[model samples]
Target: MSVWDDLVGQGPVVEQLSSAAEGTSGLAHAWLFTGPPGSGRVTAARSFAAALQCEETPRGCGHCASCHQVLQGTHADVAVVRPQGLSFGVGEARELVLSSASRPTGGRWQIVLFEEAERATERAANALLKAIEEPAPQTIWLLCTPSPEDLLVTIRSRCRQVMLRTPPTAAISEFLVQRDGVDRETAEVVARASQGHISRARSLATDAEEWRRRGAVVEIPRRLTGVASAVVAAEKLYQAVKAEAKARTTELDEAETSELRHALGENAKGRMPRGTVGALKDLEKRQKSRATRSERDAFDRRLLDLASYYRDVLRLQLGAGNDLFNVDLEPELRTAARNGRPEDTVRRLNAIMQCRERVAANVHPQIAFESLTLALRTG
Candidate 1:
């Protein structure tokens, strides 16, 4: 296996990065990786970093010690920056620039892989732009964002861009079966359900609770019989998604707090020094922002699932031959199509999109979801 093995359906990108790693043409000091969510932007960057540091011939030999270190995020020369809160600020960017300016410890390139680069505040981005503009002889920057427009025009113009596409359902399904040993039928179902999101498909294939959560979401349309049911459904969905998000983040938050307390001279009884309270409070504030973002993102996934259900109904109503995203709910979708007009399905979809936008804008989730469910019921 090579470093690019895990990057499903990104053959052209793999080729381009491999050639650069081999000291061929298309090499650049700064690279921008842009792709939709779950398109493996960070994965591609990390793989390229590994290849650049690999000790074996052909650059990306997966078994080499350097390749392993980079892939596992233990390489001294590679720094992976993942923003923990809603925004990355100027202070953190300054620290990053300082770290990235250092020469490589292992005689290879000093690599900085910045994931979610779009989350950088304007000041932070300006700091990053300066870093990219001024080159360290051994430094390379890998920036990952959803779109080139997410970064400053100067930064975009400075970097070589690698665009990743959503992998085909067949590729994801085969990968699940071959790599994870999932049953073929189950793999196919999750593959189609994920809508070309490789990580999501893997989770759906392996995580029983995730499959169950999706089931609950797709069933919401059928339960929207009246205003009361709609309100109740909305509340339930909101609570479930919130709980999932909290579950995902609680452990990380606890670990971070514990580490900070120890760094602040906490004793066996967990008491800290004077003036440490302020630092703890700041960490708490950042953790809260991260939790809020996680909840919003989780709820948005549920909304997309709801949208898929309505889209399936619309497809059936219009006699479109396209495959349904909710394949297991085809019968229920057919019933929905028979009972509703295509126009109504379109209106419900619009409402779901509106709710997603409102939630992203920081509207209270319960209020947004409630409004959405009422619209869906009426439609």
Candidate 2:
């Protein structure tokens, strides 16, 4: 029912954050909040920022105008920057530094939130460090990343770190029932299935399209019977993942490219500039890198889904319980696990990880994924 409740079952994190809200630790100007995706890193940052800005007693009055604006992203003091295409380059970092250096208009703290600080390039990280080292008197810098290893040690050394843990299934299920109005049966199922990924739990509780997509992916392992089938599955994954990556990055890339092209004027379009060729090549390189990262991220999500299906199969093979992600596909799980060994399940998981490593290393995605499908199909 409140912003804090949106974060699944992080009672310990909530308690620590609440203490921080009450002016504990002298209110350090910099904080790094790190966790897995869907673990409410940004959500925690926003709530903490709102609590910082609230004038009401005990802070974080969700009903206050300040909290309203802060939550809605219209507040003057709190600024959140989610990287557009891929990397947060020096230009973006400089803008963030400038915003943080300015006086807060609302007479509270100026909070700059970096969502996915792991995506910041080395140059951008240095730019951010300069601002953090000698910050504005009233400014607060909050960085959210998947892990501290993703950030420069120099930058992290200056900030207080808040580590987030995935909540237990019981707490997660209770959270959904009390705060989201979800029924107990559905809530418990989603809680267990999501493995404490709060946002994913919520989506699984409500979304049908997601189930269909995951269903298609889980079914592919069993359907790979021939070279043609394997190739088609590989292409299906590539096209699906590539389309998603393109959908996310294309508009942003075009806008940035247009801006650069416009700034150079009509003479620079086809005519020679001393550095034009190099810049073009550099741009292409970064774009390709970003595309690969996005595709891998998407594929990883699917792999996790496949792993979950296998997990359910493991439980079923042991007669643990009736828990199933694809309630409609339970018979399929029964059929598949019926023949698969515990070692076979392990081999499949390892194959998925090996495929991920290949993709991360910039292997040709089509070949890598195709090999993965074939290996898991018959290995």
- Give each model's whole-structure lDDT: 0.92, 0.79
Report the C-alpha displacement of residue 370, candidate 1, in angstroms. Answer: 0.5
Query: Model 1: which residue pairs collide?
Result: none
lDDT of 1 at 133: 90
Model 2 bad stretches (over 4 Å): 175-180, 244-294, 314-331
Instruction: State the lDDT of candidate 2 residue by residue for 243-320, as single tens digits.
Output: 767786788678866666666552745554465667767766777767666777777777777677777777777776
Top candidate on lDDT is 1
Model 2, CA-based lDDT: 0.79
Q: What is the lDDT for 62 in model 1?
A: 98
